[model samples]
Target: MNQTIDTILNHRSIRKFKPEPLKQEHLALILDAARSSSTSSYLMAYTMIGVTDPEKKSALASISNQSYIKDNGHFVLFCGDYHRHMLKADEKEKETLAYNVQSTEYFMIATVDATIAAQNMTLAAESLGIGACYIGSIKRDLDLVNDLFQLPEHVVPLFGLALGYPDEQQEIKPKLPKEAVYFENTYKDDEAHMAALDQFDQTIETYYRTRSTNQREDSWTKQMIKTLHNRRNDRLTPFVKEKKFNNR
Candidate 1:
């Protein structure tokens, strides 16, 4: 495989990082790569905040319950932002139908933009031999995160990314087989799909058993089922509404 594809396939979440900081040049390049990602209709609805203050990082770590959030060489919060667009439209005396924070479509576009940008940054970091982990647990306390970042209306912290030099090694996790996820012309949930899922469960179980860290003898299906049974993120809708993203 080519270098790009090889890097993509070898991706792993690095939880433990060395105390060293990233060079300014590398950080700039990574941010540039993130901004190069595709933006929905060029709205570029994503905004990235690099957190460096010790007290702020400590608070964020508490909110995420992940010490790495504070210890990483760099912690970046990615936000789905539409406030900039709205302000620009107002200045131009232009009507913005899509800038309505309550519109689900607009919200989705902003989310897509943020997610794409984050992935681009992830790939760029990995290519530069930097280790990175996506701290999605920040979503557990969306209100606190919003308050900490002073997010205005039409802005939401989607996730935080922790990046630094690796202090530990980890095995690359397995993913479901292509047949189980990819569809051809139409969607199908027949015996073939079931068979692929069953096979993938075994594959996942083996990976968990043999992984270098946090080894557990559980299949992907079982883990997902248990997680789903907990009914997570019940507060997410309310938080969004509180942010005045009232459009459905």
Candidate 2:
């Protein structure tokens, strides 16, 4: 297989990082790779905030309750942003032209654009032998995070990316089988879906038991059930609306 494919297949979420900071040239290259990601209709409705200050990182780590956020060489918050577009419209005396920026369609577009860019940045960092972790727990207190960044209207924080040198090697997590995810013209029936889940449960159970760190007797199904049952963060919709997104 090609080196690119190898890199993609061996991906792991790294939470522990070395004390050294990322090289300036590598950081620049990674950011450039993020900018190269495709945007919907060339709108590019997203922004990345690279946090370098130790105080800010400490605040973010508290928000996320993940120490990696503070220890990582670099942290970047990818935001779905339409405020820039609005400013441009106002600048050109064409405020009415960008009236749909708050619509749900535009919100989805910006979110997807930000996600794509973050994935590109992750892949670039991985290719450079740098470790990276996606920090979604920042959403636990979305308002605090927004305030921390001092975001303007029409700019919503989506997630954070922590990049640094690896201090620990983690086992690659197993994913669902190809057959379980990829289907033909029509989606598989309920029986087939259950069969796939059953198979994956066994595989994941084995993985958890065999992994070197945090070994446990659990399956993907159990984890999913627990996660869904305890899902809390009900503020997402309200937060998005407050940011002037998805108003339509």
Candidate 3:
């Protein structure tokens, strides 16, 4: 197998980091690589807030409920930002910033732009021999995080990244079967959806259960049911609507 293919296959999320900090040169290269990623219609509608301060990292950790955020060498909040264009328009011509936001299409474009950039940053960091973990819970309290960072309107936090040299290794978890996901022509669903998923859940449960001495893990279906029934995620849809995307 090719070296690049091997790297891709071996990819895993790394949360524990070495005590050493990243060098300035490596940091600059990662940022440049991320900014070089393709943007929609050249709008470049995204921005990143790099946090090296311990206080700020602690704040993020408290918000994310993930202790690793404070321990990592660096934390970065990637935002889907359209405020730059709005401000520019306001400067050049007197137009309300919401003039084009009535449609949700533009909001989606900015989100895509931000996500692509964040992925580029992750790949670039790993290429530089640094381990990176994505912190998706950064959006849990948009109001709190926004106020913490003093972010302006028209910009939303997509996710965050914690980067540094890895101090520990974690096994790369298995992905679902190709047939369970990949579709050709029109989308095809396995007729026995529950059965197919049950098989996978058993596979995962057995593997982890054998490896650990802790309490037995719940089945995949149980976990999914608990997640959907939980109140934690119910706030997200309402919050997004409040942000003005208005999916309805």
Candidate with maximal TM-score: 2
Tell me each candidate's TM-score: 0.94, 0.95, 0.87
How would you encode candidate 3's per-residue C-alpha lDDT over 1-248 as one tens digit per residue?
97566666777899899887788898899899889989889988789999877887888888889988888767889987767776646553524455465247877887889888988888888887888998988777777887788887667778899999998887776667666676688667667555667787887788567753343777677777898888475666666655555353
lDDT of 2: 0.91
**22-100: candidate 2 lDDT, tens digit per residue:** 9999999999999999999998999999999999899989988889999988999999998877664554554553457
Kindly give the stretch of ten consecutive residues in candidate 2 with the minimal lDDT sum.
Answer: 88-97
Superior by lDDT: candidate 1 or candidate 3:
1
TM-score of 3: 0.87
Cα lDDT of candidate 3 equals: 0.78
Rank candidates, TM-score, best first.
Answer: 2, 1, 3
Q: Which prediction has more favorable TM-score, 1 or 2?
A: 2
- Give the winner by lDDT: 2
- Model 3 regions more than 4 Å off: 90-97, 192-196, 212-215, 231-248
